[model samples]
Target: MSAKIAVKGLKKGFITDQGLLQVVNGISFDVADGEFVAFVGPSGCGKTTLMNIIAGFDPPDEGTVKVDGASRSGPSAKGILISQHGSVFPWLTVQQNLMFGLNGHAPSNKEQLADHYADLVGLKGFEMSYPHELSGGMLKRAELARALVVKPEILYMDEPFSALDALLSLRMRKEFLRILAEERHTVVLITHDVEEAIHLADRIFVLSARPAHIKATFAVPFEHPRRLSSPEAQGLKESILRELGV
Candidate 1:
């Protein structure tokens, strides 16, 4: 299949007190249609900056980002970004939150769509719950539900589960995969967790520090519902860490 998302010679930088601070530098990659890809690197390596460019939230200083063969100009309704700190509304109930983006739709249609997505993300009974009332895992699920409700072509996840505790993170990974498989959602995840990348991605991109570039790319051969404790998975994790120079 052709690339659903293609980036070439992508470079980005920011102005700081120390002058221009380069983040991404001469990076290139392609995410196939319906594929789950992950970027893994040390902190400050610009993985999130690259993601933002691909998601059309930030324009690169050089090169290009294309989605479905078109150069990305800005954020499109076809894609959604789920930040590390989820964008859930504290005051909105789960039901109302789900309905937040469905403006202009008939009430009955919105209600049905909201209910369907709520159940899809395992939030069926918590529709009345507020964001503060839900556990960390549930809050992530609600955010996922909110994004999926709009039928995005791609999900830009910047460490969607990184804020949770270890146990909760594990559980959320499983839940994320389960929901993603059912929906066949395409994703590009930015994560510093090598284990998380190895466990979840179809392919992994290891990036260099500071002026980030693709140091290595590994195609994970294992299927989903991955056994993280298995020797192969552990071995891959070590390999990725080595690439990151950790």
Candidate 2:
């Protein structure tokens, strides 16, 4: 498959009280079209930094990020980021939140589109509910709906389920997988959870600690609704954990 997104010699740093803090160093990778790729690493690694550059939320001090063969310098409508910090607007209802990004569409079309995605994410009856009325999982569904309602070509997720309780996180992952099966989009996820990465990604990239670079890459050979406890899955998980030095 051709690359839908490409990175080469990517480096980023920051000025701190102690002097220059290098976060990403000479990192490079490609995400194939409609592929679900995850980056797993130790805390303080540059996974999020690498994601931000690819999403056009930040610029790299060196190297390049190209989407569809074009260098990305700023955020594009074709991509949407569902950040770890959460993007739901407290003041808006689920319907309103989904409608927020449909500004270019006609009013009637926007309403229908919002309704479609809201239902798609299992928030059908919660259309008029505000963010505060929703549970952690529901809020995540709302955020997912809002992003998908825009029909972005690529969905960038950063620790999207990190805040949910363990059981809820598992449920959401299953729901997310179902949704992905129905709606195909290139997805790049950043997560510290090894099992979550294995469960959701087509390919997994493990990064080194700060001044991060790719340490290893693994292909998840299992099909969807993977059995994590199966011997093969457990073996792959062990390999990944070993790479993470867990």
Give the candidate number with the greatest TM-score.
2
Model 2, total clashes:
0
- Candidate 2 similarity to native, TM-score: 0.97
Candidate 1: segments with Cα more than 4 A from true spot:
none
lDDT of 2: 0.92
After superposition of all CA atoms, the RMSD between model 1 and the true structure is 1.3
lDDT of 1 by residue, 42-64 (tens): 88788778888888988999999
Candidate 2, superposed: residue stretches over 4 Å from native: none
lDDT string for model 2 (74-171, tens) is 99888999998899899999999999988779898988999999898889999999999998889999998998988889999999999999898898
Worst 10 residues of 1 by lDDT: 43-52
